[model samples]
Target: MNTDVDQDDCWICYRCHKKLELKQVSVLYLGGRFEVELMQCPQCKMVIINEDLALGKMLEVEKGLEDK
Candidate 1:
């Protein structure tokens, strides 16, 4: 999937009003952990997962794990 949002674009944090930084984050799902690049707030450490990652790579991983 293609995203119109630029990868370098600055994102704002809704909770702390701080700039969101792109960082490598670990996601846990169904007893599995995976790492993906995501936007996160520095102060709150809140990670934002986009639709493409959630529905694409993560979904594929989930299905693979379930099938095992």
Candidate 2:
């Protein structure tokens, strides 16, 4: 994992307000039509979707919903 802190990419915990580190967290997307990456806060251990991945997943979800 990259240790560099990207202020734009990293998110802080709402409760603790600590910077989320990439190196200390793991992302897992399971049982979805398309694979997705998740960002997790190291301090508070909160999981969030990164912007680009979220958009891609949104597209996939939209397609799935439309097909249904």
Candidate 3:
């Protein structure tokens, strides 16, 4: 996925109030772990899990993994 951040879509870390940068983030679901480029705070390592993702790809992956 092209996680290249668009300035309009930029996110700030809730805890740090810092701009989140694109980095490889570890995601876990159903005992499975994988890395995907995501926006997160460099200082706190906090990741963004937006609504589109929660109801979209992430949900799809979770269901697919659970069916395994």
TM-score of 2: 0.44
Clashing pairs in 1: none
Q: How well is each residue in 1-68 modelled by candidate 1, as lDDT tens digits?
A: 33223568888999999998877778788888767678889999997777877787778888998899
RMSD of 2: 5.3
- Comparing 2 with 3 on TM-score, the higher-scoring candidate is 3
lDDT of 2 by residue, 32-52 (tens): 443323456666678665565
C-alpha RMSD in Å of predicted model 1 compared with the true structure: 3.0
Q: Is candidate 1 or candidate 3 better by lDDT?
A: 1
RMSD to truth, every model: 3.0, 5.3, 2.3
What ranges in model 1 sit over 4 Å off?
A: 1-5
Q: What TM-scores do the predictions have?
A: 0.81, 0.44, 0.73
Q: Tell me the lDDT of model 1 at 68.
A: 94
Model 3 scores a TM of 0.73
